[model samples]
Target: MIYRMLAINIDGTLLQSNGKLHKSTKEAIDYVQQKGIYVTLVTSRSFPSAKKLAKALKIDTKLITHRGAYIANEIGRPTHSSRIKEHITYDLVRLLEGFPCQIRLVHEQFSLANKYKLNHKLLSKTVFTTGDPIVYSQQFVDSIGDTIADEPAHPLSIEVYFEYKEDLKDVQEAIGKMYHEVECIALNDLRLDIVPTGVSKLTGLLYLAERLGIKRNQIVCIGDEMDDIEMIQACGLGVAMGNAPFEVKRAADWITRSQNLHGVAYVVKEHFRKQPQIEFLQKLNIIK
Candidate 1:
């Protein structure tokens, strides 16, 4: 079948383990855009970080960011947003402070974290850059609660990092019981992302698809994480990287080489080469 849109995840799918984009990946993306295909970055990262990578690749398509809570175009104007409520944010911060985890409030314009925990390696990866820090750089606050009190309208989601499995489970359970409208997703073994109910990469993608007039079967999604599962399942062609977890690979229609091997370039090259014929058949309703 013909594919019109390519939704790619960032962390594991695009960036290598060293957190750098492959040269071939950029070439492949440019190749697809040359073929008249729409390629978008669907990630759990904040807009600033995502935008930084997209600019590096010279990608101009709309971005699905904040774990599907927000979608914005090349200029960073949000086309849609699903934000967490103020009361719920207050409740979450209060409940999480009791645990030993570090909490970060993610917003469209800026992010806020505790002053003491901003130096964590992973968190720093998101907040600081090699030279100039992007827009999503985290601001260390003395108290997250007070930051929320000062500017409650800016939050899009909450990110929590735990050192122990027990604390993670406890926080997950507490969130489940207290806020039915909130959803907690374990981005990895140690990181948990909290967004509003019904928000996901697929949700944001669907909105963008409707606006662009693209169909489900005409889209290809490539990802390598639990949060990527939904879009991987929903898109017409789902691709998983070789380094993806067992479950993610199982959910995909195909698996490519690992990130370091330039898997994204491989997929785009192989698929778009035959796209003309596929597009012909699809338009004729000869292949569903």
Candidate 2:
């Protein structure tokens, strides 16, 4: 089948484990855009961070950021957004403060984070490296509640990082019971993103697909985390990195090399080489 678009997850699929984009990955993206294929980053990263990476790749395609809560190619102009109400955001921040976790109020313009301290250093949980720090840095405040009250926050989503596994579970349960309109999504074992009930990367990609006139089977989604599973399953060719968890690999249509091995570059080079033949359109239900 002819794939018309590629949706990439920024963290594990696009960037290597060292948190850097490989030269080959950059070239591969450039190559796809040259082929008239739409490329977008469907990530949980905030807009500034996602925008930073997109700019590096030299692609102006719209980005799906904030765990699918917001989508836009530019700041202050969103084609779609499902932001948590300021009041809900306030309440969620208050709820998160009770646990020993770091909380970030994510928005397109700025990010507000609390000064929560974890006694033990959790792996990769303490640092917010999803985006370029210099481009979109967090302003640490003693009390996020107070800061938001001073100027009400318009957050697309709230990110929580935990030191204890039990705390993560507890917060999930509490948020589940306290807010039915919002949902807690586990991006990993220690980090969770709270977004509107129906928002997800899959929903975000679907919106982009419809806007771009692309079908489900014409899209290729590559991701390596739990949050990526939905988009991976819903797209035409689901690709999982070699370093992805077994479950993620199982749910994917194919597995490529790990992040360090230039997984994304490999997929683009192999799959996008073929153009859909006219006869295959009938078999793919595209010409019925």
Candidate 3:
């Protein structure tokens, strides 16, 4: 099928396990954009963190970040934001107080977390997508619920990270039964991302598709995590990285090489090369 837009996840999809974007991945992205296909970074990372990678790749398109809670263009201006209601955010924070997990509230401009969690390794890992410090500000608080109540805004999502999957599972179940307005996504064994009920990479992309005037069927999405499952299921051409979990791979239409092997390059080169535009260039003795 002909595709007009490409949405790619950053972690484990574009960026390698070591948290670096490979040269091959950059070249592949450049080729796709040159072919006139809109390529966007769809990631679970904060906007600033994701923006850094997009800039590195020379991708000027808007990014779908925070697991689709926020959608913004290359300029870092949000086009759409789906946030948990203020009361719901407060309620979740309250419920989470009984647990030992680190709580962080993600906003468009900055992030606020419990001051006590600043040095926690799991929380630190959850804070920044890369080793480089983010341009955005990070504030620590005594109580996330108090912080949100005092300074109410559209928080992108609330991340609760635990020391083990069992803790995360318990919290997920509690949130599931307690609230119908929010959804709990176990990003891994230790982190659970709580966002609005319907928010996912697919919903975020749909909003972007509307803004770009592209049809849903014209979009191709690639990702590697459980948070990516919905978009993989919805996109016209869904690709899973070789390193992706079994379930994510099962949901994909195709599975490419692993991140370390430059899977993104493999997918883009294999698929976009077959497009009429690229084929014409090949037939004309231009690009090999």
Order of candidate numbers by TM-score, starting with the best: 2, 1, 3
Candidate 2 on 49-157: residue-level lDDT in tens?
8998899999898999887888999988999998788888888888878777888887776788888776665644466754567877678899898888888876778
How well does candidate 2 score on lDDT at residue 160? Answer: 83
Better of 1 and 2 by lDDT: 2
Per-candidate TM-scores read 0.88, 0.90, 0.86
Candidate 2: residue 167 lDDT (0-100)? 88
lDDT of 3 by residue, 165-240 (tens): 6778898998899999888887677878888888888888889888877787788888998878888988899899
The lDDT ranking, best first, is 2, 1, 3
After superposition, candidate 3 runs with Cα above 4 Å error: 74-76, 117-132, 163-170, 278-288
Off by over 4 Å in 2: 123-125, 276-288
RMSD list, candidates in order:
3.3, 3.3, 4.3
How far is 62's C-alpha from truth in model 2 (Å)? Answer: 0.7
RMSD of 1: 3.3
Report lDDT (Cα) of residue 37, candidate 2.
82
